[model samples]
Target: METSTASPPANGRVHHPGLRTLVQTTRFHAEHRPDTAAVICEGRTLTYDALHRGSNRVAHALRAAGLGEGDRVAYLGKESEHYYEILFGCAKSGTVLVPVNWRLTAPEVSHILQDSGTRLLFLEDEFTQVVEGMPTAPPETVVRLSAFGTWRAEHADSEAEFEATSDTPVAQLYTSGTTGLPKGVVLAHRSFFAIRDALASEGLDWIDWRAGDIALIGIPGFHVGGLWWATQNFNAGTTVVAMRAFAARRAVDLIRDLGITTACVVPAMLRMMLTEPGVSAEDFTTLRKTVYGGSPIAEALLEESLAVLECEFAQIYGLTETGNTAVCLPPAAHVPGGPLMQAAGHPYPGVRSKVIDEQGRELPPGAVGEVCLHTPARMVEYWGLPDKTAETLVDGWIHTGDAGYVDEDGYVFIRDRIKDAVLVAGENVYPAEIENVLEAHPGVAEAVVVGAPDERWGEYVHAFVVPVSGHEPSPRDLHTFLVPRLAAFKLPARYEFIDRVPRNPSGKILRRELRDRFWNDSARKVN
Candidate 1:
């Protein structure tokens, strides 16, 4: 009957990455904590044993569909247990999982499918028409996840006989850039939990993943912060309750209904929840810890949230390329109106971070420069981009595009971003990508995009356009044109008709000249 599960690979090709794959963790929890809940959403709960069996079926079914080791499979959906099942399934069978941003336009989704050469795509049935409308051909095998139960039933619920180790490439999360193309950050399973596993081995329970802890995931599935934080609990056999989409009321309701003990959100998300009509301080009583990150937090927002939530509030700073949180501002250091709260906390265990000058020389403490990190959590490479991999992962240090400084106490303070990335409500919106879309219009001669300060959303995408001699483009006109090409968050909120965009001798748009006006009075250059 072949009921026995496949054993860990003996190839020695994996070369002892010093970490366990998701497959090993799932099986271990299923055997040791069979009845513990791993995930909960939309009135359904998947216990450890159930998650293992479901993922096993998915792995076997995918392999039967002609997908082999190292093949690429993609998922496009909102948050759900089904997503995790497919993710762990891919992990079990040595297939790479690419989760596309569901909010992306058809053209955006098409670009990923074509770029990755994906063979299989699993998605919600309602989005079938989206795949049909792709600018390029969709994957060869498309499975409607609405029929997942039947599809899984047709395959065996046992581990696929395969050779996969912790070092095997597992996920490819796309991060867009100034080059106007998304770069896939290929990560291994070992890097996924490198920091957490290190902390656990050292017997430190900072975030404290207890057996009965209910972790809340309110972020979108496409972003690493959303999936990465939630799965940390799942890997520890703790219960995780997640939302299909993040909304102010939904996050508040989940806390009330689930007695959620832990959660992570961006600053804007916290503001939205605080301003929600029915929300009261009592609503957040169950939250033992709330982690916020993505963009730097404003002081007033920090104070207000700490006062309202009445829970331990911590700040995490990291990038999709660094796996996750490399620096954390612990609860104790979140003192309002104090010097400690202003700086991002020290690096995580086994993580070394420093700021460097433009010449790549390490800067002394309290110097504003680019932030660089040395951590096991660094991505293996940018998928299929050798030059970028070399440029970024130099000397075992990943160069973060953020301009920041570490204080005498080792607290990192972000001053500005070296990358042309505008963060709108925690979503990374590359300026060049938006500028390209703007310049595509017949009425626009040239365009530049820059971050504008905002009370909410941290920053908004503001575009300055030099109209073509004969044609004039209004804010409404430009907004309407861009709505079809870019995500709503990435679209310019305000448009300024300009004579010409400032440029240097080399013809590079001077984004700093445009950005400086908005942040004139602020000490921090970033919004």
Candidate 2:
């Protein structure tokens, strides 16, 4: 609701410190933009001063409840101002903010809370029943965020007396279990600052950060975009407009009404926005940058987005383990050329990226191999899993497990994921979970889930099942069985009754073979 024309320094460089350690922009804005809108959601706005004070109050309340440094506090709720407030409050207290995906089933939710040993849980009105039902959830405490409650009026104007520093763990984001079970990725405050600096070094002009800029964040807050984008915006003293979830209509409405300058969306979300009913080009005028990632955006959809949004389109690629973005495809590179569409651009400053062979040897340009990244922005390790941590982080590099290549121009191009993880609508769905559910059905003997290209979701979940002796279930039957067990997004879009899933000598499902049928030589497969 407020506007400022001052741009960041023009040297394509941004000085970033730890989330809590960085006080320049934060303190400056707390004083200057106290009355300006900071976070806007569903017709509700919280100004800079209010957000800062609310965060301080939340921090105080957390500490009073015995939450402290290195402690994991589960944020189980929808996307709203409460999400950011709780997360930032955790940062202030040096506590680890574990944002639970609200879509998870009760059992799945229990697994996360138990696995992470979450000491406290902050719930929304919708999830109160779920938390109440789980008796064995960490045993610390649970608090609800709502207007009417026994919760005191704890909106403190003074900063909470909490230790917040660079080495503090700010987030413990769980990887969407698309390969095996989900693992908690531990990210430190240093990693956040490192990424901001890395992006600035990779040709991201700091001047782009205008204090008046409103970032339209439609992505779910549980993911990296929600965490990192908010950090970046807060560090630059920019305003953030939080949409609870991605609805194409709602996003377009906000873009037009709020004069949103930038938005971070996946390919599927972009497709929906471009094709939204009654959406006009004028609706996206204030929009300046459209950052697309999570999954590769096809050339066709990219061009369509360019035409419709009429803004600078940039591409970024990274995983949760790498603090979200390691490589970037700048707006200039997103031209009508063939190479630009496929290239995810250069690695960020202070980050080293390369294509590596199975032997860990670096591959040459144009040679497709596993993409490897080394950056200070990378996570410290997987929480409570030392062996797995070692396997992922070796020699200073975090194995991305994604297949890609580097062009002569130093741009990176993603080909496919080497990990047996299925990306359904940008959400990582592990085949093991889906297969486990399928095997639970009396009619299913063996099952495998794999990623198949889709025009709509970038990739769709596909299940290959082997029916048990004297029993067989149709696709509808499987759907019915899974409806109550899994989230709607994780449900397989297509089910194929197969004789036996392709496997090697070790009996590991040859996901490549299953995926090849759809993604072979195709940018995307709709079905």
Candidate 3:
């Protein structure tokens, strides 16, 4: 059951406990289940007692390196069981944990390191070459944690010295820019725990896997899904099964062979798993629940998954600033014709969501507007971008910039991005609506819409499309498919064939880059 010592205050503001606040709970599970396995990595395992002691040692080592409250340390590596030990250790030591993106190049990584003013970086040997070349890399400290023994030997019992208070920032997730350069979003300790409590309040109990239950993590640990899985599984005393990288075949084999009871995946990953060779409905019997998000799952895919996996699926939605998830669509909501899949679900227990216009005026149900979220889980602010922060966050509501509509039942239906709206012949057209129409074409595999410069019109709608394998549809055929369905001005003025559209890990199209090529050399950038 959801438990909180304090209640929500007035005007949707509520004070909650901190992230390091759960250390005692960790300690409790450790003492009671000392020898029980806590983590499973490459070929080694660590028990709850071992993880507790190992992290305590990490705290001591970090302190010896001059790390303490208010200092930020970044980690650039793949997801492993040891990652959490380092994260929890930072949580205990009152230091902020900054997880860097491993997919990025050295220069990309350098930008974050320099921006965060990261005092120390803990990286695996795989990234040694990348780190050695970065001139902007911090001189604070560099440590290599290879094996559990190395950490255990240098460890000191300093758990007491490491305590994170409610207001202390726990971690920082650098935003994935759909606009400009990424900004670091700092989350507080209280913010983390409160959201966890909110998840529980909705009868969404943490998976009750015992110490022997293998919890497979396929996504990069730097992402929220991977991080949440590690901590929550440890919090529930489950054994963590780590994957350095994701391979669909390997992920399926692990679940079938290792008895993995819990897992998390994004919509794209789920789609890949369903298409993997030799994959069968029986192969997923060991998976008790699968948590998916990052983008909406199509009804067709959801149905196929329900039939094949035969397990509970939870669709959660939230940003880095909202502490992973402020809303979740539970398994029961997955039934056919149910309202859940059509929405992002209601706000998490302590979270309040509303649809509003640019002026912050609340819109009535069924009206499309920006999705605004107000929660204690909001980050302190965008790191070093006070002006941008003020523009995005107003009156405590983080303007999602996502155009969505809420039904009378409080269900949210995301439409598209406000910035993605294209202007053609003095009319505004949402690319998502156009893409949706295009995706419905049987011969269309993928489609992305962007505004291109036009002499007559300020901007014209252009579509970059991918045709289905073994099927060829001419431009005239494709245009015919849309002409009958959409307004003339909203139709694509031009179309180009492509193998695929460029997208971020979250599956959001990089429209700006698509438009950059032509606009860069144009006399009038907007023409």
Once superposed on the true structure, which residue ranges of model 1 sit more than 4 Å away at CA? 1-19, 176-179, 420-527
Among the numbered candidates, top TM-score falls to: 3
Candidates 2 and 3 compared: the better one by TM-score is 3
Cα lDDT tens digits for candidate 3, 1-527: 11323223332222222223645545655776788877777777788887777777777777777788878888988867678778777877778888988777777788888888889888888888888778675547876656544754676765647555667787887877656678998877665566665654554442233334567876667776666656666655567788777778888888898888878787767877888988999899988788787765666567778889998887777777766777777677888657565677667677788998778799999888899888877768888889988987787877888888888877777777777777787777778778767876878767788888787888898989888778968888889999998999988988898987776654546778787776788875455
lDDT of 1 by residue, 377-452 (tens): 8888988889989998898898988877899988888755666678788876767567756866878766778888
| Most lDDT-accurate candidate | 1
Steric clash count of candidate 2: 5
Deviation from native of the Cα of residue 328 in model 1, angstroms: 0.9
Which pairs of residues collide in model 1?
none
Candidate 1 residue 258 C-alpha distance from true site, Å: 1.2
Ranking by TM-score: 3, 1, 2
Give the alpha-carbon lDDT of every model: 0.78, 0.74, 0.74
